[model samples]
Target chain A: MYKKPSSRRIKKFYAPLNLIPILDSVFILIFYLLMSAQFVKIFEIGSDLPIMADSPPSNMKDALNLTVDVDQDEIRIFTTVNETLYKTIPLNSDGTFDLTTLTGILATLKGRYPKENAIVIRPSSLIKYDDLVKILDSVREKGSGKSSIDLFAQIIFGNLGG
Target chain B: MGLRFRGRRQKKQEFYLELNSLMDVLFILLVFLIKNYSANNLNIPENIVLPHSVASKQINQAIVIQLTSEKKLYLNDILVADLEKDKELADGNIITALYDKMVDAKQNIKYKAKTLGDIHGTDEIVNLLMDKNLPYKYIRKIMFTSQTAGFKEFKFIVEGKE
Candidate 1:
């Protein structure tokens, strides 16, 4: 029982895990995701149908019902309150809308009536959707980042006669 | 000479790739891609160029209506009416064909909500994907048709840009 222990060492057998299949699957998944990825970001601008009545409701009478009339050559800013004309900004010499002037006017109006949120946009048949969106962008906000001021957030699409 | 030959054989056998680092990098990439993946299923057509805007409101689930620059009207990617040919079919401002399609779509959504236990209910919302170059008259017609079809809320889908 006390004899010397054998000097022969015991060997450990370890089987390596094959990772080829996992790598193949991972590569396929990455390729599929890359193909289906949405590169362009899509967003939305909300609007409401034009009210049938010529004037806003009694409750909204005090609020500034701002209306923007976008034509081919000029953008007319007005309010339903007493049918007042605020400003008329003509297109630039390069045939682009003067959005900076429109934003300044909207900021002034927003400062005057902070509670009023509704605004009606009436784009003429000649104005393109791109131009209308640019006008909308300018009317929705004034500055950028933390200093940005929200203008008319409630947008209503109105017809020419409405 | 025998020891030198054995050492050369061992060196040849040890020429294997170290893939642990590669696996770690791939796993990180996979996690990143999965996290940033968007589930938005809106398939904007190639011909319809959405207008760019600073509006950051994310798009919600709603019935989609597309208007191409060619004046083709599509409800959920199904061509319902051609503004060029169906000019007479427009009753005042509403496109009759589009209105019918929208009513059908609304009914289908309601039925799905009832059967599938969806809680959103009939919100009467419609998302409009329009070409940037399209005139406002076409948009007016679409909006009138949608309103007549009982869609109260409208959202314009546009490409997001700084």
Candidate 2:
């Protein structure tokens, strides 16, 4: 230390101070915020619910409505106008829903009827909310052979009974 | 080798700290985190497990309703009603208490908009944050109550994936 003082007194020039430790601390802080940040992606599924209006119901009662019936063992798809069944897909062995077939069917239906954008999801009272959400996810989008696109995005939450 | 080392040591008597490479790595990490970090202010309750979806749009400013797994209703994080407490309330597809709560919320928004000179359009958007395992009856009741509360447009808050 004493020898360094003599050399400093002789030399007029000195090296600049190192700021690496300060930079290191700031970088550490930045990393903490980066890792702790939620950065969550929140998406919305838009729907229009029936309001209590002063006027009577509109003439659009004959509108094309694609209804999905959620059952414990099977999921039934059909149209309101024609009460005939469109398809019957049974649940998986583990009791979880199978959306692969649902996606294919909806894609074909969407291709045929591009104007029909409304899909009413009427889950049974016994069905779990998770299953209801899974069904909605399946109908919300479809693959168009080339790329994935939105299917019946207008999700209508059906009320009790018909 | 000893001769070469002695010559090199004599040439540079000053101590040099090489931190440029370490700083470069830290800077790269900070940039990556900053790019992907989303500034989300959505204060979803810890107990509320949002449904998952492949695609969901970013949430906008709206009336937020949170329903926990216990079938508890929360308006803007305020606990308004607990379905488990009242069996009668759970039986009906439309909940009157929730409707009243929403009406109050709508009135507050309307008053704020009026004072601020901002006009809300014909439709009012309601954001829903519901648990993934609750029954469909509770969901239907919530939707019906929201409709009765005078909100026409609705948005479901879901965990989004790219």
Candidate 3:
């Protein structure tokens, strides 16, 4: 006679995982990150000292050589190649530099001379650094986001009185 | 009746707070924070209000030169000189104290590069953090000094205008 196979049931136990300690550690980590986080974004604008070359590069012989002279009352945009004065934008009636006009003029120049990438910035001794940076922002590019275009990206710090 | 009441009380179910979802949310938060964490060690001084710019170039590790609104100069967070006194000490357009400091910094960088077996010296870049209200004369002097000390690339640290 064949014996019938005995059926047995295995009991499985489930244990709760301890999470209080993990929660404490996570809270500590979050607090530390929040304390050390940089809330404000910091960035850089690069400028180079004019190269001490005897002659201009062959490709740049007829370049625009754009130069911007910033003063307390007015900003003069001119070309160093032929000393051609492009435009002079004066401060607004509210005592602020007219960046919109500057940007418009820069965009026009960029359209006419698309290959010219260098811009010489000569800020007067009286011009504040803040104002100079505003001028730089206006000169660096036009528009924003996807439609933005670089006006003059190669920045050179012109001489004190040049 | 008292034994029957005691048996009923003993049969009451135990309650537990579920935490798996909270743990999952915390893990996601940790990953997000870790992904966005930046290792830049540049510590902006409280007295120096950086100029705002639209330039998007991220700042890199380099020798830092800071000019506070009070005309104080700092090299890598160490108070090195007072600009007011240094102006009188400047030789022509170069600030003597800053020039000497930059020379020392360059030498230190070169020495470190040599120890690391780099034939060319480290990048000749300097990060300039100047107070927004500072006059360009001071900045000119600093740039001239740094140039004379063999630093060719200048990065002006600015607050990002988003």
Q: Which candidate has the highest TM-score of all?
A: 3
Which rank order by DockQ, best down to worst?
3, 1, 2
Candidate 1 per-residue lDDT over residues B50-92, each given as its tens digit: 9999888888888999988777888889988778777685436
Clashes of each: 0, 2, 0
Model 1 clashing residue pairs (backbone) = none
Question: Per-residue lDDT of A13-124 in model 1, one digit per residue for the tens?
Answer: 4556677788888889888778788888899999876657876478656767788888889989888667688889999999999999999998998898888888888888
Candidate 1: regions farther than 4 A off = A1-25, A50-61, A145-147, A160-162, B1-16, B119-123
Docking class of 1: medium
For model 3 chain B, the run of ten residues with the poorest summed lDDT: B114-123
Error of 3 at A33 (Å): 2.5
**Model 1 chain B poorest ten-residue lDDT run:** B8-17
In model 2, the runs with Cα more than 4 Å from the true position are A1-36, A50-64, A143-146, A160-162, B1-23, B117-123
Q: What does the TM-score come to for chain B in model 1?
A: 0.83
Q: Which residue runs does candidate 3 get wrong by more than 4 Å?
A: A1-11, A17-28, A59-61, A160-162, B1-17, B117-121
- Best to worst by TM-score, what's the order? 3, 1, 2
**Worst 10 contiguous positions by lDDT, candidate 2 chain B:** B114-123
Please identify which of the two predictions, 1 or 3, would achieve the higher DockQ against the true structure. Answer: 3
Model 3: DockQ score = 0.60
Over B42-131, each residue of candidate 3 has an lDDT whose tens digit, in order, gives 899999999988888888789999999999999999988887666675436877777788899998888878787655335599999999
Q: Pick the candidate with the highest DockQ.
A: 3
